[model samples]
Target: MKSKNSLIPLIFSLIFFHSAEAICKPRGFDYIQPSSNASTSTSQQQQSPSPSAPAPNQVPSSPPSTSTPISNANSNPPSSEPQPPSSSSSSPAKTFTPSPAPPPTSSSRPLAGINLFNQPTPKTEPTTVDPAVKKICDSTDYPTLCLASLTPFLIVGKTDPVSILELAIKASTQQAKLALEAATKLASAPNLPPRKASGLSDCQYMFNDALDNLESAMDAIPSKDYGTVNSMLSAVITDSETCEDGFTGQSPLAEFDDKLRMMGSNCLAISSLISPII
Candidate 1:
């Protein structure tokens, strides 16, 4: 009885609020309801995907991104399609065969290089002084002396008795002149006895005679006068002997005198071999 009017106004306000709230709310088309008042509610809300985020099952319209391959120097590349090897890789490299060198000829020889074979040097043969040296020396009185002295003077193959005799006389003449010089020096001594001084003087004169005879024989030998050369060389030996006899006991010129006679004997012997060169 006291508040009937206030209750009436409160009931009007609640009805107005429910109507206005329903009109102002945005409608969700995603969900469908069988009745307006009886709406179906779930524990989780199912969200529709945006344009930026794709679903797991959906395929991309554009191509997938490709990854770049890493290169390694030591690693071998994998072969594709089980391919057969090309001719360049599978075949052997070409072999180089050098041409054989030409044989060495007399006209053209290879240049000298290192002596790999260690070849020995060629040996030279020994040679005699002359072809007729042994034959001529074997027939002389002093064969060793005659060969030794005449071998240096003779031609290789020539043999003439006159020429041999001339060489002999020349050798003998040299020895005789040496003796003469010795005798001449001895004879000029200041305090020499009359006997030794006279003997030395005689030796000098005899040696001079022997040398003159030998020189004459050499001149006569070129003309093939073997008879004159033989006589002259024989006188040369006699002159040397006479010089030796002038001294009594152990003469100072005994060695020279003996050598001169021996040389004179060789000249005499060689002159006898001359056959007049007809």
Candidate 2:
């Protein structure tokens, strides 16, 4: 009976040993742990739970809990590192910068060629007659009459000898025409004396000759032939005097005598003015 009891205890010890071994040993498909040296294994065996304790599946679940803290640590580091780059980029965008305006070009200004410093000046012309012409007119026999007669031409700024001679010829022609008309009217008048009628006829012939001489002088003036012009003008003066002489000592005839004397004197003065210029 004691031997049987001893056998029972031995069986119990074997069974217990087998259960502990099964619990401690790693299964083929289970997670592999780091290999431990003999001393570390002996310490781990002493701290291990008995075989009757719960299965170690709960311990394996603890590794995922530990990995949660590791994931959080990695996530935090990335967030902190990227924050500076984001802040720097945002700060640059917030600052304002404007583009500069364009400079003034040549096309913008209108008066590019106009000069402000130098201005244009106005032109002026002469407005008065020369003094030398007045001196020549002063030397005439009828100085005041000659100057007054030539005033219109002188104001035009031309007082040459030919112009004076032309003016004198025109005056003489007008006087001769007046005298010829008077003589013709007198000669045709009824109840006139024979001497008075003869004198009027003679006056008409002399005035006709005076007009012809003045015309010849005018034609010679353009050719600048002073000698021929002077001779013809002298003949005009003589004809005027002769017409007046025919009426002199015959009758009153004051009007005809005054006209003939003026015409002769004007012709003589014009011929004298022509002498020096030629």
- Top candidate, metric lDDT: 1
By summed lDDT, which 10 consecutive residues of candidate 2 come out lowest? Answer: 116-125
| TM-score per candidate | 0.51, 0.46
> How much does each candidate deviate from the true structure in C-alpha RMSD?
22.5, 28.8
True lDDT of residue 114, candidate 1:
23
lDDT of 1: 0.69
Candidate 2: Cα lDDT at 13: 97
Candidate 2 stretches with Cα past 4 Å from truth are 1-134, 148-155, 248-254
Per-structure clash totals for the candidates: 0, 0
Question: For candidate 1, lDDT tens digit of each residue in 1-278?
Answer: 54988888888999998788677556874444335444322211223164345456654455556777987979989867787778678677789999998876733643233221232221331245454655665677667667655654666445666667667666777667677777877787799999899898898889888878988888886677777778888899899889878878988887777777777787777666665343
Q: Using alpha carbons, what is the TM-score of model 1?
A: 0.51
